[model samples]
Each structure stands twice: as C-alpha cells, then as structure tokens.
Target: MSTFAKAGFKSANYNSFRPHYPPSFYKILTEYIGKEAGKTGDKVGKTIDLGCGTGVATYPLLQFSQNVVGLDLSPPMIETANSLKAAKLKELGIQDESRIEFGVCAVEDFDAPPNSYDLITAAECIHWFKDYPKFFEAAAKHLKPNGVLAYWFYVDPVVVNFEGPHNEKLLAIETMRRAQQIYLLYVYEDPKGLGVHWDRPGRDILRNLLREVDAQIPQDLFKDVKTQKYVPSVDGLLQLTPQDLRLVREKITLKDFTNYISTYSLFHNYSESTGAGAEFLEKMIQEFETELGWDREKTLLDLNWTSGYTFMRKSGE
Candidate 1:
C-alpha cells in the first residue's frame, strides 16, 4: 500500500489544513483557458485533475471546464473528495451533479480518450509519479491540440514577522526554524543508525519541489512553457501591509497549524512505523511554544508561504 493509503491518513484533516491556492492562482488558470477557448470559438471543455487529494485543486477547477475528473491512488482520499462534491458544488452555485467525478486510480492506469481534455492539472502531486516520461507522454496523449497542462508545488514556507513586538517576532521566527530543523532531523535523518530507509516520493517532492517537476516533464512534448511565482504580494497589487497580514494571521489557529503538520506523509509514515510520531510532534510543538513564549491556548501562527507553477501547451497548436 502507498504511504497515503496507510491507516490513520486523515483525509479530513488534510482537506482542512492544507494551504489553498490563492484566488489569483485560479484566476490565471481560468484566464489561460478562456484565451484558449476564444481561439477555438468554444467554451473550455473537459479537465482532469491528477492526484486530486480531497478535491483541493479539483473543486476550484470547476469554474473553468464543463466537467472535471479527480483521480488519486488512495481510496480514502477519493472517498473524502467525493463526500465533499455536493456541498462544494452547492456552495459554488453549481446545480449540475454531473460536473465533477472522483475516482480511485493512478494517473498512469486511468483510461481516457486521446485529445479529450482541454486542461490537465497536477497540483503538488506530480512529483510522486514513479515514471515521469511515461506520465508526460500520457498527459500529451490526453491533451487536445493547444490544450494546457499545468502543475505546481510549493517549497517550505517563508515566515515573516507580520505582528507582535519586533524582537518577539524575530525570536519566534527563529525558534520556529529551530523547531522545524529538529522535526526534520527526527523524520528524515536516520538517527540511532537504524538504517531506516526513507524513500517517500511526497517527502522528496517537498524537499526538491520544482526541480523534480522539471526533471519529470519532457520538454520536447510541450510548447510555450511558462511559469509564475506566487507570493504574499504579486506585482505589488496583492501586497499585504502589516495590518492586512495581521488579518491573515487571525484566520489560523494553533490547532489548524498542528493539523496541517499532521497531514504530512512523513509524519503518517513515521507514526505508523515507530508509533512515536505524535510524541515527536508534541515535543516539537512544546519546544516551539517555549522558545517563542507562545501560549498554546491563544497563540496563532502567521505562516507566510509562497508557491509557483509551470505550464505549457501541447505541441502542434
């Protein structure tokens, strides 16, 4: 079984705590699709969101395509995705039930007609594919002429001192970094010389991010390759002033932060293997709280994260 399929994988927590792609990210995708639609004199057609865990990227995609298919290898992940479809659709004012579908299948094995999709997306999950060239070939096979293929992953967050006293914020950020290093050592380092083999694709992707994406996608098969970096401010229009940043901080709680950390595949795997994941996490959290002088009951962490994407059009447009 895959690490994502391991018992205790909390799909709900993953959905709740995972960082969402900003609205601007979705806007850019829709604008690209709209421009392509204009060239064809037809609205955007079908889409497939590869590795659409808990429908994070899949749900946002509904606005751009007539239908979307979210595919993942883990049954529980698919189940959680399907469970949210109706509510999300309703929330989005979508009346059609046929607009979205979730399936338990790896992208390699999922069947689709050639030239069927107008857009294909694999957000934060493409790095897990065992065969990049094969996956790219499959993607090309499924994309229509001029179709768009977009995928992206985020590196570690860029924490900023958005609030609190200047000295306290600096101290907190430093302590957070130290806590992270300790957690990484416990999870990734084979401490105690136990020869623990840590070969998780998700973990590798987290460490390498876009480098893995570049290594996987065949450059010859696509055209008009492009990329965009998403930060707290894009083009200075979305800049978060100190006050705005404070508002952003208010949305997250300590529980939300911990829940997000728990969703990492490394934590799940570590927990399953050694039964010490929770203890390790608790110790790390305590250390961070102590170092930052944060009250666990009231402190909210301000996580300043950045992300980016690379996209290309199918050749022969």
Candidate 2:
C-alpha cells in the first residue's frame, strides 16, 4: 500500500488500466445482503468501502445503498476518486454528489459509531490489512446486527483462449501455456524480475485468494460466512458454470495486457529499482510475439483471472 502512496505512483493509470468487477458480482452481493437483512428487517443503507482505490468498487455500492463512503490510505488515490465523483455519478444516473464520499484513512484507523453501516466491503485490498482478527472485531463494531461484510479480489489473469487470424483456436492451448509461463517468469521465477520487488505476505496472501484472512474470521463476531473461489483448470481453460461469479474476464491485445501489468505495484518497484521498466515490458512483449508466433497488434487473447469472494454477517445476540 505504501507503494501506491509514493509521489511517483500514478493513480490515474491505476484507475484506467485496472479491471473492474462485473455487474453480476454485485447481484450476488445484493442477494447475500438481502438474505441476511430478511432476518433482522434491516434495509441496505450506508456502506463503507475500505481500501477503495479510485472508487472502483465504491461507486457501484450506491446501487444498493443511499450513502457510500470510500476510504483509502493514499491521498492521490482519494483525490482521483473525488475528481471522478461527478462524472461517475452522472454515468450511474445519480443526481446527488454527496450521496457518496471518498476519504483518506487506513481501514484500521477509520472510526464510526456502532451500527453505522449496513454493509462493509473491501475490494482487492484486505490482504494489505494487518491483524485479521482485530480487523473483523473492528468491522463487527461498525456493522449493525445482520449487516454484511464482504471482500473479493482477482489475481493475475491467465490466458485461457485465443482467436487466431483465421478466427481459429489453433495453438490456443500452447499459447495460453506460454503466456502464463512468461507471466510467471517475470512475476515470480526470474531472479531479476518483478518477483522479488513485491511487498511480501500481503501479495502472497492475495495470490492465495485471501484464504489466510478468511481463516482468521471470528465465529463469535460473524456468522453465515461463505467463501467462494473460481479455480481455473490447470489442464486448460476452466468451464465456468452458470452459477459462477464472473469476477474478471477480458479480450485484450498484447499492448492492452502489458498496460494492465504496468498497474501492478511490483512493476513500479521493479522499474524504480532496476531503472529498466520500459525495457522490461518491451522485452516481455517481444518474447510473447516471438515465441507464441502472434502479432502484438493482431492477436486477441481471452483472459480469465483466478478470483474469490467472502461474505459474512455480524452475529446476532
């Protein structure tokens, strides 16, 4: 998270290139909240989004709640979120700007009155939080009885399928394997790659889909906890069921793909440390084009991410 707070970090690029959560996921969230609300006769109301960078997961909350507060530790990220407030609200057909607010604060330090929020969410960020037991306790303090607390994240995208020049799935499996290998080499295997640059434990926890965090949840404070993870097949692309939550999917070119990589915190650290960020990306793209025998501009890759979500309700007395 400190990487994002750096003066050199570009929150705009992050907002632009990051993949957004699909609308279907929100429907799942609504149902989860509604199911719990049915017991307590509480309506979905104020929501607080922790680690809400640029309001990506924050704005959509307005669909269910009247007031949403997006909090992040990064000032620049908060600034960008606030800057886009008017435009995003307009796009969402929202009239009032004050319906949602963005603030700068760590999730641990954020304070609210007891029973202040109907829903509390952390999008792509709970891994960065310290002390999961403490966090759940604090979240319980803020949530009304039967209120929902949810968090979800998508890790590195895997190339599952490809459309060749003749619109064929030719070499799709091989290409997918190679693309993923390249991703791993740069992000994990290569000694000089971005692997070592990542902030430890947090990144590892997130890569594992927050299982570590989920395990730390206190049953005394929260119940009806549900954790779902979409695991892509190692043999090839996974066949997504109708019941699956579509967390991340995109048909993108090599350039588009690399741009998304640039948004990674490890990329920033690698660039700063090695002073070869541009060269690193260019070489990686060149390797993809050369080995996969695909044109950077012409090739279209269907990418899917290994993603998961956790939902829980505050335990009632």
Candidate 3:
C-alpha cells in the first residue's frame, strides 16, 4: 500500500480543495437503503465510512444513520476528521455529540462485530487498499442483512469550455487543458529525473471501481447492484459572460491552488525524496500561470468535475 504518511501533507488543504459529492448523491444512497428495507422498516442503524478524509462524506451521512464512524490510515486525516465532527455537530445544532466517531487504522486491521453495520462507504480512497478482495469479504461479514456497501470516486476534472470572448474562450479552454496536463505530467511522469513514479496501481482501479468490486465480491454475497453518474450544475460566478450554464469555480489564489496540489500523497512522497518537490511545484505553477496569462494576484480557475457511485446490498430477504 502506498504510504500517505508524509509529514508535510495537510488535511485542511485537502478538505478545502477536493470537490464534494453532491447532495443528490447522498439522497440517492438514502433512498436506495430505504427501498431495500421496505416494510421491515429498518432504517440505517449505523454506518462506517472508510477512508473518510476529514469527514467530507461522513458528516452528510448523519442525516440517514443513527451513528457514524470515520476511519482512515492517516493520523492527520483522522485528527482533522474528528475536529470537523465537533465543528459540524455544533454548526448543525446536533446535540448528540456521540453521533460521530473517528479512528486511525487500516481497513484490514479494523474490526467490528458480525452484522454490525447497516451501511459501509468508501469515498475515493478504496483504490489505496492493498487487499480489496479481503476488505470486501470482511465487509460482507460485518454488514447486516439487506445492509449496503457503497462507494464513489470522481475522475480528473475536465475543462469543457469557458465563457469569454468567442475567440478567447476557445484559447482559454485549451490553455486550461494544457495546464492540467502539465500538472499531471509532473505528478505522474516525474520527468525531472526525480526517480519518483507518482502513479500507483490503486489509481488504475479508479475508472472501474464496480468492475473491480464485482470481480472480488462473492456472487451470492451481494445483489441489486446499481451505478449512476452525478453531474452537478456549475456555479454561475464562473461564467465570463452571462450564460445558461458554466463550470464550477472556487475562487482560489495561485498559492491556494499550489497548496491543493501539494496535498496529493504522490506529490508529498516525491517532495520528501528529492527535497525539491516544492521547487518543482513552483515551476509547474509558473508554467500554468504563463499558459493562462494569469495574474497571480487576481486570477482563479473554474475547476470542472463530475462523480459517480456504485451501490449494492448484502444478499438477504
């Protein structure tokens, strides 16, 4: 398993930059569980969110489950998730302080009683697991009858088009695409003789999470499998000109953008190994800015992204 143990990686920055799963995504999850429960009236009793980074997916889960546990292998991530749990509970006016809990441990090492969880979710980090088949087998053992095992992951963002002068719009779109490519090259290619290969086997499993799961899960262990894509409406502020639709844009300074990139585990590893990872990141940023003609003091990128989910219930009436 790839170590996400880099000391310089910041969970806060990860929380800030990672695109969140849409509300509809969670709604679909709850509705599916409700439908599966049917007349038995079994609401979700408990949930465990694997790799719940900073509680991004865990907090929203509280609406459907009575108790939630956020687990991760990284202590920093678990610490941030616990902190967020406290802040979010207060913000939502939820007084049941025990509703959410967090722990630092690998999925393989974590244990629960048989038939303990009503739901289990892994958000974006399942690929990192060294033994997913074993993980699924363990999950099957822990899930209650008609319980769910759901997971979702988003692909690299795509720059469809930008709103600007007709001519400049095309150029802007291409520039954005090029900039993303450059960033990815630095992360995945390690072109600078850094002896770092940032890409991992886990990354290869992302595009086919369900496929991988299907291959690993015992046929009789799960059923009613479903998959769906979620494309949220882009933010209006990102449009250079008034239009019916545009891509989502979080107004981030160049520094913030670079910090976001630094949150990538591979980047952290590369930096630690070479001691020049920060320098390389600066070089990437400079090239990206030059490509976009960006003024560091007053430029923001409209990041475009979409996500998908796969859900299935434990086999039982």
Q: Point to the candidate with the largest lDDT.
A: 2
Poorly placed runs, candidate 1 (over 4 Å): 35-43, 162-198, 229-251
Give the residue spans of candidate 3 off by over 4 A.
35-43, 161-170, 193-195, 207-210, 229-254
lDDT of 1 at 216: 59
lDDT of 1 by residue, 20-50 (tens): 7765566666666554321323447788999
Q: Please give the lDDT score at residue 68 for candidate 3.
A: 91
Pairs clashing within candidate 3: none
Candidate 3 TM-score versus the reference:
0.83
RMSD of each: 5.0, 3.0, 5.3
Give Cα distance to truth, residue 146, candidate 1, Å.
0.4
How does model 1 fare in lDDT? Answer: 0.69
Per-residue lDDT of 96-149 in model 3, one digit per residue for the tens? 989889988888898988999999999888777778668878888899988999
What lDDT score is found at residue 240 in candidate 1?
Answer: 47
Q: In order, what lDDT does every prediction score?
A: 0.69, 0.84, 0.69
Question: Candidate 1, clashing residue pairs?
Answer: none
Using TM-score as the measure, name the better of candidate 2 and candidate 3. Answer: 2
